[model samples]
Target: MVTTRVTWDSLPDSIRRDIEARTGPLSSVEPVSSGFNSELAVVLRSADGATFVKGLRADHPRVWTQNREKAVNPHVRPVTAALRWSIDNDEWNLLAFEHTPGRHIDYSPGSLDLAKFVQSLRTLQELPCPDIELKLAEKRWASYTDSPELFAGDYVLHTEWSPSNVLVGDAALFVDWAWATRGAAWIDPACWVVWLIASGHSPQDAESWAAQIPSWNDAPADAVAAFAAAQAAMWSAIAEADPEPWIKDMAAAAQRWSESRRIGARSQTAR
Candidate 1:
């Protein structure tokens, strides 16, 4: 669900003062229009430099996402912008990160950004899952599949693959660790396949791209098929609840990939 966006000028005076104290009198504020998770997403510029800030009301239902991002940032180094500071008051909770300028990644077929994205994933896969409180993949997807245990693993997983979550400049950088999870390493690339399909790649082409990731190559065919089916169910529920066009597109992409996997499984069984 997209949080209602709040402008910089609309922030409570106390909150603005608290931020300015840390950032040293903001000279300019650029509201970030991408990503749905934060009520306040902006770039604050001062004589010192720029800082990226994202925050939520202290009492918001998803307030814990702020804590999750803070905890995970230190572990996920240069792959993500460094979290510089945080503020929590009776009214709000916010995190400040080193501002890095970049454009969102393009998942379209034949895009050069695809190779950069895969490289970024390879770098991320090398990092061990830090000992932090995070949602486990099996538990998160349990409602969508009977065999939730198949999704269990100790490896860190950034399960959301939306283009907005990745930025490419000198290098590809991943943001919004809000939905980060602990799961099988292969699951990250598997999740990306659906977004690839949504971006105009056929299921076969998407799988081919995912196969480039080392962990994906190690995933069992049956387990991947199961994951695809579970994802189809999961996205269907999400789209049904929101009825948003983008959500519906993702739901259709997931279903197509799931069906393709089922067909492949049947062909193998016949063989």
Candidate 2:
């Protein structure tokens, strides 16, 4: 599913010309790093200003992701880079965004960024999920869950929490909406806990950090348990499919968190 990363010049001249027609002549195109989805991630400089460009081929199988992102941006704008323009042509489907320069988030234990991240999640959880077609988290995680019913809710969730997906400026800016889903409000914080664990926080530490977020804190204990187990299964399957180190690490983290939750549940029952 991974495509070769492309630079500015890698784009077809016709495609570039089409893009330039809308944004004026591009003075320069500097490629950005840390993106896993888009083949093209660059900052295009023009007479007016710089714009962030993210795109893949128009015919790519994953082109639907671009449509999903473009649809979701207006809803999550304050917590994300503003979507400036969208181009759809035979050559490429590119989206230009207001370039927001900031450091990618650090999820390591005790990092000040953790509090800010929770705050951003709170703000995001408040935004209404724009009425659009989206994968339901319950259905998406169904194969991994004992009771999929527990996953239903009216909140739109951004399920990807890789450190690179969030940039910290005055506030944490979440990027990449391709995996966004509609489901339980607490699911996003639950997703963050796995990334925090993978980033070197202990399972208990990650849970404590997540508790700072209201949705996570207020989640029903049984529902949280279901979520943990579902994620453990989900990540384990992903790691098995492709034994990439980071994916494998996430699988292990999710397993550990799931085990910890199970043990806690048992102890509380026994008491």
- The lDDT of each candidate is 0.93, 0.89
Those runs of model 2 whose alpha carbons end farther than 4 Å from true positions after fitting are: none
Across 167-199, the per-residue lDDT of candidate 1 in tens digits comes to: 899888999999999999999999999999999
RMSD of each: 0.7, 1.1
Cα lDDT for residue 6, model 1?
A: 93
Per-residue alpha-carbon lDDT of candidate 2 for residues 78-102, written as tens digits (9 for 90 to 100): 7898999999878788998998888
List of clashing residue pairs for candidate 1: none
Judging by lDDT against the true structure, name the best candidate.
1
- Candidate 1: deviation at residue 79, Å? 0.8
Which number leads on TM-score? Answer: 1
Residue pairs with colliding backbones in model 2 are: none
Q: Residue 145 of candidate 2: its Cα lDDT?
A: 88
